[model samples]
Target chain A: MTATKPYHHGELRPALVAAANAIIRESGIEKLSMRRLADQVGVSRTAPYHHFKDKNALLCAIAEMGFEEQNQMTREILDDPEDNNNEAVFARWVRAYIRFAHENPETYDLMFGREIWKGGTPTPSLQAISKTSFRLWVDLVAKMQQRGVLPGSHSALRTAQASWAALHGMARLLIDGIYVQREDLEEIAETVVDLLTRTTPDSH
Target chain B: MTATKPYHHGELRPALVAAANAIIRESGIEKLSMRRLADQVGVSRTAPYHHFKDKNALLCAIAEMGFEEQNQMTREILDDPEDNNNEAVFARWVRAYIRFAHENPETYDLMFGREIWKGGTPTPSLQAISKTSFRLWVDLVAKMQQRGVLPGSHSALRTAQASWAALHGMARLLIDGIYVQREDLEEIAETVVDLLTRTTPDSH
Candidate 1:
């Protein structure tokens, strides 16, 4: 074990989450163990319990961090002050999604594949926070449709769903080792964005 | 245990798949044990080993069965003689996807999740068969553009990828119990179909 770090290290909650994420990144969630995590942090085996009730609780917190990171990235891209147009908004959102999925394959799987937040059953704080990220996508698409940049009366609803599908499919393919490995994800991103943008009302 | 049935049931593979799917529907893949599956078929525990080398092998076989079923379903929908127009072509494919996702969730997850494919490589049979499904989607989009029913250039590539994204996203949400539980899937499916039917040639 390492030297003791004092209690109350400015903000133990966030610190603990960062530590947990580092472990996940290195060892995968499957290999994560509570005792090992506590020892690594130079804390008593039970100290982690003060911050998280159990392993699931800690996992939820880690997932929340991942979701927030993903949402912030999505918003920054979609709500860029300069690229607020419909095509830009839609395409950028898709790009953000693929990038997030590829970069955070483990966390992405935990959030979506684990069903940690069942629809309409969003009780956990992390689960609720994750769902909020999806709202950014919904609102971006809605704004674009309102501007007459896209067609379909339910453009906001359907397009958001559609965008999700395209991004999810691409990510799945990428993670599944499809399309061969590529250094430039931007190529795929641009291809997806170009397609979604062309589907806009102006395309006709 | 039930008595033995005739070996020449003529649909041994399909029957086994159906039985395995029923097990997945009632429980999850995590609950699918080979001995239990063999018991379900009134065979010795060793019986399944002949068909599948192990649990992973059985899962691959089941996934293969699902891909074929999906391929047939997609073909039926895409080749609807009455709905051969561009809009119809897109709608039918999207609808087929929705139906497949909803009706056979276990298969859908196995096909898309990429985790259960065993050691990150799909069996050769699964790979060869499902790869055709990808071409079907891209080909339909290309044909729609060629017929001038859908507009813009590169509709084939764009719509193919975008449509995949949307459909895959929704299917994933449904399987993981996160996306469309509260909404009428049929209505949403219609909306998705409508969204894809529109000509966004520039999108591709």
Candidate 2:
């Protein structure tokens, strides 16, 4: 039960995940391997294998953490009773979403990048959390639509997908060093909010 | 000038670019190299170096091709006076944009992915053409707004950035093996068209 136990039986999993994150942050994800991670965590080489079968599993765990953080962030926005204004909450969510992606570029990349979704297998737990994160987003979209924060012209699923794609696009552009610049993040997020919230000219 | 000559005097450059594309398409971008490209094009290993300083140069060439093709497609769509309607042309552009990404996933990834834009130095030609491609897109967006195809509320640059981000996001989610499914491309594209074109509910 000592707080300083680096390789305690129950503490090893989180310690490994934390260390893996540090290693990835210091270097890139490519630099974080199970063998190196075990050494960094001050554990036996096989100790990490007990937790993560391989690098992919460890990546999935990190990605799962990202989804949980995303889900928690979304939940806070949706559940905040103090801010009943859908428009304000939606704006907050938009900024927060892009901010998370910008701040956690590596984790965001793993959460949505080809490494897990295409190049490697995502653990069932990772998939489950990822799906839940999306479901929460869709639910939030539906709520926004009902309150006229978003257009009701499309279904919740479609709107969520489209809007999420917009956010994801902005995030990826910033993260991947594409067209968007980090300084432009706030502008892009605001524009996205306005774009999604504004009624179509045809509807008017 | 003989087309049959695989390594004709001045044809080596185009030959190398073509062979590089084939190698990347068959194996993956990671499998491509200037030396291998020269071998594949039936030229001396040093031949590719004469044209492309390194693999990055070759990749820039391929990405340059993608931007050229994109610009050409946009030009064709915008110049088609036979279909003067903005809505129809805008929809076509969206479909074509996603189609280009889907059909040329490798090139699209290289063009927009971290490999060129982040990890590798983009040649001046690549930067120029990429900027041109985006400028063309922004110009098209402005035209759509003028014709009421897009919302007139946001300036062309903002609207262009936002809409392009949406389209890019959709392409990436699909390409990166994220939540999007290839089968759902049409549905998502249509929904995006709807999302962007429909007047914001508040406007009413």
Candidate 3:
């Protein structure tokens, strides 16, 4: 109580974005509301309105953050120099991607689920960021192919789409609580890596 | 309306199931309700109660029907004698699978989504049927491996899990209106076949 600072309007945007993520992660996405977020952030109801046009805008902001986080993770994997074996690095990346999805299931859903892309309109900036993130993955797939980490028989786009779909599928299955269990992730991930890299571990 | 026959109480269960499917197809899963279904079928609201204990039970029934339909499709693909080239048959199966998801997006979602399996408890019968359906797919994968349709190096379960996850991921990406487009399914499917079969078409 000694130093409670008043919220400046400039800080309002980030504060609102952070608070909105908290609300979504705590409860389901359906439970989030602009008014509730504003209230939680210790701001007037209209304050959030000044920053976000509607609840959709707030959601897009959250999805945007998700893309940024995912893109950063991709970059970090690409930049990692500890492993000269591209196969091992690719496997590590697969585990890391699935781990990210498991740790942040709600945000991962918001990023890839129908909530923003289908049920609601994504902000232009959100679309741009999402596409950029995809491009990064595709480029990584091309680099992997060049390094023989993935087969070069197919175009990078097709390979990326197909393999990424596998990863997305595994992540979704885990997130949706389908046949997959969290404990089986390591084995499943290794198998996926084997399938994508076209490695014959059994033969060796 | 002139030749409308009154539904006998004996036929209420199947009638309710049929009406539920129509409702879900016409609108969406959320629009379906026990009372609504009864009214649509010209029965008392309580009549649906006898057939389905609650909405979850009705939903499980719908999901159960989906599994049966999916199983039948898988069987037909497996039994198809028209194509002896296992690779061609596998590609055809992949294309057919994506088309099924595209055509029955809502049902597919219900069958696989968090709606029945995660958000609600699946009926015992639903669980059994779903597992059987998965077993059919796994068996097919093992057969393909034995025939050199897919790589034989991995276990059937792992190969099936990895490749099926790729298919499920692609179907879901399309279903959820993500980056994948319906028009590109054929090309993408061929690429998937090559990846899973480890066939380098570019080599020749």
A27: Cα error in model 3, Å: 4.0
Worst window of 10 by summed lDDT in candidate 3 chain B: B195-204
Per-prediction fnat values?
0.47, 0.73, 0.61
- Candidate with the greatest TM-score versus the true structure: 2
DockQ by candidate, in order: 0.38, 0.54, 0.45
Best model number under lDDT:
2
Task: Give fnat (model 3).
Answer: 0.61
Weakest lDDT window of 10 consecutive positions for candidate 2 chain B? B195-204
lDDT of candidate 2 over B83-190, digit per residue (tens): 856568999999999999988888898889867775689999999888888899999999988777787887888889889999999998778766667787779889
Which stretches in model 3 have alpha-carbon errors above 4 Å? A2-16, A30-51, A81-83, A199-204, B1-16, B30-50, B81-83, B199-204
Q: Return whichever of 2 and 3 wins on TM-score.
A: 2
- Chain A TM-score vs. truth, each candidate: 0.76, 0.90, 0.89
Q: Which DockQ value does candidate 3 get?
A: 0.45
- The alpha-carbon interface RMSD of model 3 comes to 3.3
- lDDT per residue (tens digit) for residues B1-204 in model 3: 547766666688898999989988888776888889999988888988887888889899888888898899999988887856766778777888888888888788888876677567899999999889888989899888777777766688877877888888898888777766767766777777777887322223
lDDT on C-alpha atoms for all candidate structures: 0.66, 0.83, 0.81
